[model samples]
Target: MTTTTDSPRWFKSSYSNNGGNCIEVAANIPGAVPVRDSKNPHGPALVFPADEWSSFVSAVRAGEFGNL
Candidate 1:
């Protein structure tokens, strides 16, 4: 696991309407993207490689998941 001394700057999409099933992502971290539940800010975060995260976001934006 990658560890960093810097704190994560969490961000949630504006499209989220306070829905209970929303996730917050921290893009400020270098080389990694940390994601956690918006409802549970104190909970554990799942970190992914920055490149992988970018690809996943691109796929979502391109509707690869279909009606997600």
Candidate 2:
């Protein structure tokens, strides 16, 4: 089995232009979602399971987290 590292290629969300404090995520990793701070590329990344990450996104889009 081979392990893939997602330390590179962090893509910012298209809706992050106005919010300078937003974070970015590098999607479609081998088995996890790689997320990192947009202002700090050299910083550490937080990896999340695909299912959990998707649920979080869905909640955010559906206003489950309240006002954006």
Candidate 3:
């Protein structure tokens, strides 16, 4: 697990409207997608397999979470 201190490039959704509840993701990391709260840049991040993250995003676009 790499730390965010390495300065992994993080980006939030362009649709994010400066809300305090958003999250940021660093997809540049090889083999992983690191996700952290946008409000807490220095906080611990949850790293997910890139493929899994893609699947999750797809599900979200597909409305799997339903009204979330």
Residue lDDT tens for model 3, 1-68: 66543768999999899968999999788778999999888889999998999999999999999987
lDDT score at residue 57, model 3, on the 0-100 scale: 98
The alpha-carbon RMSD values of the candidates against the true structure, listed in the order shown, are 3.4, 2.3, 3.3
lDDT of 3 at 36: 97
Span of 10 residues, lowest total lDDT, candidate 1: 1-10
TM-score for all models, in order of appearance? 0.88, 0.82, 0.88
State how far residue 67 of model 1 sits from its true place (Å): 0.2
Q: What is the alpha-carbon lDDT of model 1 when measured against the actual structure?
A: 0.89
lDDT of 1 at 12: 94
lDDT (Cα, 0-100) at 60 in candidate 3:
98
Backbone clash pairs for candidate 3 read none
| TM-score, model 1 to reference | 0.88
Q: Look at candidate 2 and give me any clashing residue pairs.
A: none
Q: What's model 2's lDDT at 29? A: 70
Candidate 3 is scored at a TM of 0.88
Candidate 1 vs 3: which has more lDDT: 1
